[model samples]
Target: MSDVLAADSATIGEPAVNISIFGVFVLITLVITFRASRNNKSAADYYAAGRNISGQQNGLAIAGDYLSAASFLGIAGAIAVYGYDGFLYSIGFLVAWLVALLLVAELMRNTARFTMADVLAFRMRQRPVRMAAAISTLAVSLFYLLAQMAGAGGLVTLLLGVSGEAAQAVVVTVVGALMIFYVLVGGMRGTTYVQIIKASLLIVGAFVMTVWVLGKYGFNLSSLIGGAQDLAVEGRDVAAPGAQYGATGTSKLDFVSLGLALVLGTAGLPHVLMRFYTVPTAKDARRSVVWAIWLIGIFYLFSLIIGYGAGALVGPERILAAPGAVNAAAPLLAFELGGTVLLGIIAGVAFATILAVVAGLTITASASFAHDVYASVIKKGQVTGNGEVRVARITAVVIGAVSIGLGILALQAGINIAFLVALAFAVAASANLPTILYTLFWRNFTTQGALWSIYGGLIACVTLIIFSPVVSGAPVNPVTGVSPSLIQDVDFSWFPLNNPGLVSIPLSFFLGWLGSKLSKERPDELKSAELEVRAFTGIGAEKAVAH
Candidate 1:
């Protein structure tokens, strides 16, 4: 059976065809990035695309950025193996946009210029608040980038039939280099265009696959579900809940923690919040999210079919033994559907998805460092716009190199991309969200409060994660005789939950309130009033961003 699986995967994954398709996609996106770079004449152009993007266009770009490798590759794989419990990721991700749309999107567009630090530092001491926010942004972006980079390594290795740590490391390095090029040359404008193109391709590809899979199951949803269920081991129900997360008390609590992180994380995610500034007005920002919600919603529906289709056709056991493990389900399904041609196309699009996402994350992290920390805090806002942009480009290269090294480590550790993204969400929600909500709504919020929320939450969340089962102490999988934790041959973990959001999120909020009560520095009434006026009315917001 293992031999048959190996032979099938080898035949389906044609290196020549996959490489050709991958080359074509890369060439077209590079040209687009070059074209977009022509108009990057100012910091605004470099950072926020000159705020000229329309509602629909920015919406598509948001979808492109949001529908990452985790969405297409990871979630689909989860559903194929774990059944109904796997679909929870889709639900959590989609519902996250509502929190963004209602709480952050329009207000952030109206209030902030380039990054989350802009709004976060509006009423607080500029230096401290900007420094903390920048740190939090970089942390979240780094975590998110690790997942994309690791996915790239696994993805290209599978496509090219390469089998070694060195080969996978080379693949990760290439992806990191391309991502840096996109940010250094194209900036946000170029990154946005890449996302738009990638988003379109991904949606179209998934739609076609969904249709093909349904046709195979006689166009009946029930038949598809039944087919997947038929392949399940005895006493296991793929169509019912608890297949993955419900067997134990700790696992059930972990599910709740994961849900909290996902549902609240989008509003706090630095890259997602930064997308709001790419549009012209508060209305456009709101429109962008609405459009993103629609597109993202549709794609996830397609994922439902494709995931079950993979289960019915490819089987979980075959997926487990494949080169990419769970992440191989989508491509394997593509291979099963239309042979090498389809597989090539899917592989190329999947790689594009990784490239586009990492480019966005790299740009966001670099921008946060350059704008918030270097320009605002270190330089005391004395830097020129062009100088700041130059710093951002340099930062992009540094961040790219860092992500490459970490990606190789993660690949070696055999971590799941989707689970890594969930950790990123937990960090974002715990560190950023509490301060954002307090700053916007709490009248007595102070600099100390913001500091406590951002730094304290960040410290607590990361510390918990370091001590959690995700990092170590997970029991070995009986079938595979391997631990799922990022670290192996150790059991230092003491935290019970896989995700720390359930604890860290509430703790952060409490700390924010307590810090405010303890602070001797009173809130600035004039700046607070100005912030609220600008955030809700956008009266002087346009002039503030004007070059």
Candidate 2:
């Protein structure tokens, strides 16, 4: 990507201004972290924000965590270049939250505490169920962390004109240190505050960009779209969904599979699930989802206009001219409309975006480690109070360090992580979702069933992704001439599809039922009844530990 930038002579044109704004965003978040650390004293305060975060605030934080680099930059860039198809991704993402709202939110809030393992282990055998859930959570969260860090590393280079491997390493490690602080010191309280701040700034930035984009074309939608089509240097119709996904039966199936992952995956994500535990009541969890729906919905709707704004103002050719600048479409559009000051604001927002997400992921990963693995499995539930808090902090540092190491490698490897995010979604959907639904809804669900579903989904999703054509070769970008293949010379993908969700999701559901039927153990009817009353009515539910 550095080579690509050099080849195109791409420079920030004014690095000082961008760096100053970026620095200011970091400083403010650091102050928030300092304050949050003071109030964080117990396990609940460390992991779930002390069950005191309001619905509206958590809603904004949810938006902050969910609207990642993909939503803010990648989707907008896709719309700028590919038109309507880009907006499809936003719809899929937003629609997934509906699954969480209707089926998972309140029930999860009622049944579980710090981690998803709490829910699974509530009615099942303790150690094994926890192991399965924790492993699955680590798989999904760590994979996402790697991708986010890598994207952050590359974007740091793009945004601030930071050069060389050393500089990129410093960027990732510094980000990692702050992530450690956010997770270990500030905990969920700090993460939630950062996420809300980031989400607010993102909305404000999008509003400014939308206004400029519409104003550039006199607020005429047709003219804006027409100008966008003219900016399509590849001659593909920018007004309609393109031929790439429709070009073959396999691609169409892949599209369906990707859609499945995106739509069903949110409920299963560890970080997203942990949000439920941070609120005082089940109704608060439900209301938070509603608030998230409104905020996330408005953001995606306006993002389409931002995409069109980029197309009308920046043009697809120049966006393509700078490699890895595809993600910079919206930021560059900001630069065009409102100059360096606006560009600096977007840059800061993007940095804040990555920070909130990483902090959220770090907490979830560390909590799963502390609550599920170290405390439950290794210590046999012997750990408590500051002991658990100590383990969580250590895990956060370890996770943060590993993320930085992986981020540096990613910058050097130049791997395209576009597929990794999809893979994360697919893993969550296939591996985690079935087990959650079965445990909550099925009377006959057994320990065997839960373990099989969790392990089976995890193994199946990872294995299939490794063998899929997306990891080898499926299609090339028409404009960039770069193939979507992870390996440049390899073409040995045995899997016919790009996404594993279609096969893996159903397989997970089937395995759960089969395991339940084949197991010798009987379902614990009494425990299920106990869980049932609490899950629905919030009676005898787990309470947040007071600070």
Candidate 3:
């Protein structure tokens, strides 16, 4: 173990630790959590915060929702490893917010009383649509939660020098408990405030780090590119020796697939969509989306700089040996260039980023269970106020436990953080996005269509992913013995794109359209659908109230 540490230090250098920064972060988080708890009241307050959140606050929360562990740690790691291709993910992520702003945001705010299920079931009976929506929401949220939990575990273990399994268990327990407290005690009010604070700090930290990196390299674009090119060549030789790592042959296809997944997948994420609903009015929802876009765009731009900086400064060989463990790349760079204090600041910012994201995800999942499933479905819309809040709190605990369990399991599988995140995005885009989009925009969309699209797309994506050659330990070919098949003689050798969004997204649309064509429609239901559309478009609200 000592020799291994020595070798890692030789390659990656020794990472500096600052316990004081961590202590400061913990203090701030607890304070925010306590403040949010004071605002907790009835179920409405807990889940939607009485639908009274301001546009700016909600926008900040949306940014918080968007910037997850994947965005922070995974993107940096990707750029460090894959060069320009990795930055493509950041661009793709930013572009998808455009779809959110123009299409889904105001419509979701106008139509749904609370969750995504309200939008899906706006025209039809609640049971079938709510059940389908709940399944999709929970599935996507849980998958995302697992990825975040795994990331947290990895970060904790790396920072504190603890055993991996023990670190994972600790993260699961701590994050899970905090999440429950956030939802039960503070609800949406608490979650929203925490997200806003974290998002602001994250953007500030990233910008500071980016500027410092640029100054180090003299802010010359050509020089930076030259450095990256030289480092890519040298690092490739050092790591794989004679192996190419850029957009070469099949890898180009993988890049496009990944880009498609990230771009389209953002529109479908339940947690992101839920943030828009917290605002009071549809106009605020629209405004919040615009703000979120600007914020996210700025952050992604910073991410590109940080990624390149990591590639040039840290090198790929050092990043790969412990990809999941390195949380302080930006801080380490700051320390090497600036000083220890800057490193401390960056560490605090990263810690806040993790906590804010996890808290938002936990609240989103809790809402799905408490409101969408229990109050809206099982209780037949009879639940109200404090009872509903209690259920949400209970659901938070359950969801947190599940996330912890999956985080522990992920450690055993040796999953990379970025890969897990991509999987979550693929599932979200494939299953949830199609149903929500069609339900809002297409009047002819039927219950059968929504159900088929949600379940069919989900099953298809998961099935393809299971058989895809991308699974880390996927069985080796009997003859060639390579884990990922490249030859035609192998049993499966098509679609080198590991992410299913490129294929599954279109398939979901097709399934939805086909299902709508075959289903029977009632005249009264069509009238109700028209009314819902008018309401969502802001034309029928007064008349809707009059009736």
Please tell me which predicted candidate would have the highest TM-score against the true structure. Answer: 1
Q: lDDT tens string, model 2, 189-279?
A: 9899989999999988888788778887888999999988887766578777753466678878888998999999999998999998888
Question: Each model's RMSD to truth, in Å?
Answer: 2.4, 2.5, 4.8
Per-prediction backbone clash count: 0, 0, 0
Residue-level lDDT tens digits of model 1 in 170-288? 77898788878888889889989989989999999999999999999889999999998887645679899998798999999999999999999989999999899999989999999
lDDT of each: 0.88, 0.81, 0.69
Ranking by TM-score: 1, 2, 3
Better of 2 and 3 by TM-score: 2
Position 487, candidate 3: lDDT: 23
lDDT of 2 at 268: 93
Write down the lDDT that model 3 would get.
0.69
Q: Using alpha carbons, what is the TM-score of model 3?
A: 0.87
| Per-residue C-alpha lDDT of model 3 across residues 462-538, encoded as one tens digit per residue | 77776565544355533223343212234553445567777788898899988888888642456556646664675
